[model samples]
Target: MEILDHAFMQRALLAAVLVGITAPAVGIHLVQRRQALMGDGIGHVAMTGVGLGFLMSANPVWVAGAVSIAGAVLMELIRMYGRTRGDIALALLFYGGMAGGVLLTSLSPAGSNANLVSYLFGSLATVSEEDVVAICVLAAFVVAVSLGLRRQLFAVSQDEEFARVTGLPVRALNLLVAVTAAVTVTVAMRVVGLLLVSALMVVPVAAAQQLTRSFRATFAVAVLIGTAVSLGGTVTTYYQDVPPGATIVLLAIAVFVVFATLAAPLARRRARAAQAAQGAHDGVRPSPGTADDVKV
Candidate 1:
């Protein structure tokens, strides 16, 4: 409760809540579609923005917001143009952004290098009211877009070619997915920082998918897992004097491992029960009779 008394901590908590909600929501689709690496790529690109911010003497979050949007759009374009190996394109953009950011930061004054470290590791204690507001706004935007385009996004995620054949604007929706992921990465960066942000975005979603069937149920479960990690990490960091970002990432990984292990046994049990049901059914013979048999 004392953490709430401090304005900075309260801001961190608020921003974390927003990040927790949006990151896993978008991440569910990414993981389902096997685009987990794409989220990592986006987060790396965001780091380049962080470096650019330090170079420009502006807030890194603002730079991250702007550059990541462009990066996301570019990812879409590259995927469209390349037409086959989008993952390679994503990797290219990620490294290019990181290289550019590093170059910019190296050109900066010696004393400013420490600023980049904050971006690398994260400093929730340094989170400001403005940072909180920006994260909240971005998270809200991601949520609105996700909800508004849920059906189209779902169709696209399930099968892009099918969605396109069905007149679902697959290309535009794909771009929207990239952009949404970028925004989610930006928000996650604030809480978990760029390095571990990808884990925060992914692990919880993976955990949730283990327990759910339908898309809506998966989303709900993911949110719960993410929220738990965000809040638990906050408390752990406060009490244990650990790095908040790393703590949160580790928490998420722990959840993923626990759930994944549990799911294996559950899946085995289900398989066994299904096999038993089939065996029992196979033991029965159908009554052979014509439909018009007059016994009735």
Candidate 2:
């Protein structure tokens, strides 16, 4: 409570909440497509944007968003047309983006290793009002795309071939997803850092899956879990004087463990209940040779 008195703390917590909501919102689709690491690749690419911002004396968030979106679109193109060498292409992109960021940061007169380090691992105390505004706008876009077009995105994510056959623009949707993911990476960068943004995006969704059987349920629970951990971690950092990014990720993992541990027992109980229902539906049956013989 005392921590919230600071303007920086308020901004950090707000950013954390937005990250919590938006990361999992975009991530669930990636997980559905088995492209969970796409966020990581985009995060890597976003580094170039951050560096470019520093070099040009611009807002890193917007620059990172632009660069990451371009990178994501390129990745999608590779996925669509470069199947034979997609992994190789992706590796190159990831590495190039990171190297480019480092190079640009080194060249910037106003930027230093310390400046880069803050974005790399996050610095909650450094979040500015402009950053919160950027994050809010970006988060709104992420949520609208993720939830508004859920059916179309889900169809495309689950099966591209089938979705195309059903008259959906699969390629467009795929690109949209890539773009949204890129935006999410940027949204989370300030709170979780570029290096760890993927974890926040994917882990909360994974944690929710342990307890949910339906996609909607998973989405809802994941967002809830994400929010909980983000706020929890933000608060923890205030008291413990630790890195917010690491604390948030660790808390998410801890929630996943708790959910996984509970899943096994819940599964067994559901199985037993299903068996009982089946037995009741079948009605009581006589033993092999006991009941019918008595009548005779």
Best by lDDT: 2
lDDT, candidate 2, 1-296, per-residue tens: 78889999999999999999999999999999999899999989998998898899899999999999999999999999997988999999999999999988888867565387778778888899999999999999999999899999999989889999999999999999999999999998988899998998899999999999999999999999999999999999889999989999999999999999999878876765565556557995545443333333
Q: Determine which window of 10 residues in candidate 2 has minimal summed lDDT.
A: 287-296
Instruction: Kindly list the per-residue Cα lDDT of model 1 for residues 178-226, writing each as its tens digit.
Output: 8888988888786788777778778898888786778999888888898
Off by over 4 Å in 1: 83-89, 108-114, 280-296
TM-score of each: 0.89, 0.94
* Clash list (residue pairs), candidate 2: none
Total clashing pairs in model 1: 0
Score each candidate by Cα lDDT.
0.80, 0.91
